[model samples]
Target: MTQDKTNFTSQQDRLPPQSIEAEEVILGGIMLDPSAMSRISDRLSADAFYINAHKDIYQAALRLYSQGLPTDLLCITNWLSDNGLLFRIGGRNKLASLVDRTVSAVNIDVLADLVMEKYQRRQLILAGTEIVQLGYATETDLPVILDEAEQKVYSIASEHSASDLVHISHALADTFTEIEARHTGKGSPAASSGFYDLDNILGGGFRKGRLYVLAARPSVGKSALAGNLALNVAKTGKMPICVFSLEMSTDEYVQRFLSSESGIENNFLETGNVSDSQWQPLSVAIAQLSEQQIFINDESCPSLNEIRSQVRRISSHYGGVGLVIIDYLQLMALDTDSRVNMAQRVGEISRGLKRLAKDLDVPVLALSQLNREVEHRNDKRPVLSDLKDSGAVEQDSDVVIMLYREEMYNPDTPDRGIAELVVRKQRNGPTGTVKLLFDHQFTRFKNLSRGRSF
Candidate 1:
């Protein structure tokens, strides 16, 4: 029994998942039919073939196809010969054999899919082996090891082939479908900021796969605005909202949300000084908030990789997230050499966040700090150039909303109770300012009155 078990283990270890027949059929089919390459080029790559010789042949054919040449047997042979890979792939006889074995290219697509499945299985096995090695490395921190293991597995699961170009007709069809959905009241492909005028200025609201930078000077209510928007999305959208509170504790953020929802002063909540009448609304707000799907990570100075891993875990658990809000961008940690400048570090962070938004297909609202240069200027309102440490913030973001409260700088100004959300850079829509009522006490923002001046 022991010998049999050892033999079984050895056999399993030697043979990784593969389908040589399917790989051969695909390689042969591409040469047999000139049009077969087009059908599977996007779905299959040379790496998907388990056999090295097949990988070489398929790669040769791909080279031909890329150069606008037909991937017939003769072309593949000549290309492989010119590249000195003909002998490495078993020479011209190997190509002839594949063609002779393949009757037609009818099943090439299905065969390609099978080869890809085998490839993915092999990849998963390799990932598992690496994960096992990671487990044994006690020198590394436990969280780091776990994160590396999860990333290894996640990469395999989320791997995608390079996309092919789509014709305009197909693009138009998708656009019209989305438009029809909105026209029929199904839903818009955006999440409203819960402020009416702001929504209008944002086309509808924050869109999926886009980074929205909310920049302001210190204490200008960017964090408050992000919290409010996150709460609004959690309340309205069916999907969960993730908040990475790099600057504040989760308790602090929850208190602000409670203050906004219950109409209680944030200071009162922080101090546990709620009045008798405030208890009722506070209770109601707590109940409402308890039902909302909002996940907060109050990790201080978390790196981008850590954030991505947490977001992926939360998204996997809750089906998907509607939005991801980073409390403040500057505070997030970046692992880089000491020689790298802060500006370049920040640019890398912004680009990484943009890519994260795209990968998760959710809107990412990142709160940023404006440089003090705005303070020296006559107009305290921030512009794209005021984005601290990086211009990539403006270049990568789809929308840049600068929060300006004149009261912050000039306490006696007419806009004491008003907040201006200057839509400075909008990639897809008009740029303008949307005014809202800023309630300093409750740390909340609301739509301005119809006839209100400031």
Candidate 2:
């Protein structure tokens, strides 16, 4: 009989070692509801005044009504915490009726013996056993829990060798499918800012989830170009856009936009050189701009998380934000812990911008500063190598462009107001030059082509 009992013993019949909490270890090891296990586990880790594994189930019912694992657990905990009750093993009624704390049976052998008289208890264990055995799920209601757990491991895996190729391929294929869907001639209600070369270069206008880096030496009109694009996107009432200015104030950006829209000139606005008649048109343009769906956030040195949070809030308030303009990429701070190289950081930032674009499903236009190497070159036009940092930026970016004007180098050059939009790298299509009209007085870019003009 002793030998028979030994042979018949189950895995859960083995009790946890004394070093670990027996209740928690037993629950964690079993093929039971993971949410139930998680609540018990959490209470032990924390210096909780109390703990009731069923408390989460009860609280989830009280809070979310029909809560499932994870969500149910969180809802119950949050509700209990908010109500001034200790999140512990025993629960209280509305009038604080005491509940006797009963330790869950840790020994499966003991549990089996007890369940022999109560068959319902044994059925509960068998119900979710298949998924636990297969490692497909943590609980019946939390089918995707293991999937998320796997992703967490995969994200930081040091060695993604030959075996990870399948996962990588599927992710790439899904991304390509989404890209193909968006690339197919989708039109917006906004009027195209006239400038055929610029329009052709940008594939129409400042799109969502794209960063158009307008890089230059210290005084090469990075702000001016950014302001121009902001104004252009804003003019299209149909495609709403928002600009986050890290380097400039909202008023400063607005003035630049007005200078571009009203033809009041940047110098005139800064130096207060405008006539009374010019103020009328400027005021009119301001009023017109106010009614448009253009939003500007001028917070300085915002982290990527802050930027994303603001974008989410703005998108939530407005139906959705179509274009997000970051005055410059390098100005933003990385708040997440990263011991990676500077190149890796820049790549991470670049990847994040791309992700934001895909998440929002819109173009992200970000200005960038070119390295001094552009100045060292005989031709001052910016090149791909001059991009601030990282091979990842060049690799992950869908389109890489540089704004260069020869007139910025030599004032005597005949093409004083002409800007060359060099498509240094185009991942999806052809690489070419698109000529744009750069109005020096008013920071604006307009289409030189006949029909594309707004």
Candidate 3:
């Protein structure tokens, strides 16, 4: 029976990735200085420790701290013993040994980091093992299996790097700090869209961690406006902008940008019929644009996962992303079950993009197509209900803007070249309409001047 037991134990052996020493040191540091846990309480989790006993101890300490109780060695040991867990976690002797081995809490940060690193490594190995098994299995479809595998891997990365909740007091402090900076001519809360009137309507600019939806009917130039905004943000040189063009190709967007920046006609550039006088401006525009930190991804139908991954990659390379623009929302591939309705699917995408904006701490400017029902109306201007596929787009967005141009419907009207940017809904400011000049030849939109007429 002893030989059989030994053989069974040997056969069940597995080497899990861990750092037991680091876990012990972190726990010890916490016991040494109760405040040590406060420094990394948000960063560390119970699952971060490889040893079950250490995890339990850390959990207990966290509970005490959260309840405003002491986390000293005596308090923790007594609590553990009273809860009938001291024996399971190796009793008072093991607890004493941890405190004895620790020198100070100064190195807690390094020790906590080591523990987290080992936890992530173990998660990676487990995910990889599951992926290998899936690769060998023939039960599920390959694409489905790969999607699940990617989700598992990305979830681990996200969980370890996610942000913590902030108290309202801290948020208020940040708000007042930004206000003071603006008052002293230092900075604003968000990046300006570069249109004076629109910026004023938006109460400065596109605020951070907001989802701005720009919806318009076909041929009303939502894409053109989006491109103009991207160019304007790039010109600021404050922070970089990333554009995910699920509809337009990179070369196509570049041409539109050139036309807008150089004051050249789009058709003229398309046909290569630019006069010599236009050549200098085109060259200058190209140089200026090339110097700005604008990145474009022309993926035809990217899922939300792909967009998030790309955003992270760009932020890593450029320090951070100032703005993220998706050409139009409908083109984005929904990351949900196919059995769901179109409205529900679009709602999921809208919610996901909003969460992404908050997670990345950048504004997401997503262009969307309005429903065709506006065409039958006498006014012909879009409203909140005109948002296609989902009202959730209207609900989830911090700002919902619709573009309207009367000249498109009535060519004889004197208001030619004038476009209306109707701010139908703004969570933090007033909602109204602002006019701009739409230069169709250049495929650009510009702020309307005081006494200017087309």
What C-alpha lDDT values do all the predictions have?
0.85, 0.57, 0.84
Which candidate leads in lDDT? 1
Q: What lDDT does model 2 reach?
A: 0.57
Give lDDT tens digits, candidate 3, residues 389-428. 9999999999999999999899999999999999999998
What is candidate 1's CA lDDT for residue 297? 92
User: Mind giving the per-residue lDDT tens digits that candidate 2 earns over 1-454?
Assistant: 0011112124466531122133233322222323344333322222111124433333443344334334323444455667665344344332132111223324533332232222222222333353355465435334244433333333322111213225778889976875565466454322343455566555565555565455566667777776766666556535567788888899898888788778787788988988988989988888887877777888786666556666765675676776787877666634334576567776777788888776555677667777788888798887888887666667767777788888877989998888877888765566788777777777777655565422
Estimated TM-score for each candidate: 0.82, 0.57, 0.83
> 151-196, model 1: which lDDT tens digit per residue?
8877777776334689999999999998887777687788877777
- Write down the worst ten-residue block by lDDT for model 1: 1-10
Descending-TM-score candidate ranking: 3, 1, 2
- Whole-model lDDT, model 3: 0.84
Regions of model 1 farther than 4 Å from truth? 1-14, 67-104, 134-148, 161-164, 179-185, 273-280, 333-345, 373-378, 389-392, 409-414, 449-454
Clashing residue pairs in candidate 1 (N, C-alpha, C atoms within 3 angstroms):
none
Name model 3 segments beyond 4 Å from true.
Answer: 1-22, 29-43, 103-110, 121-161, 333-342, 450-454
Greater-TM-score candidate between 1 and 2: 1
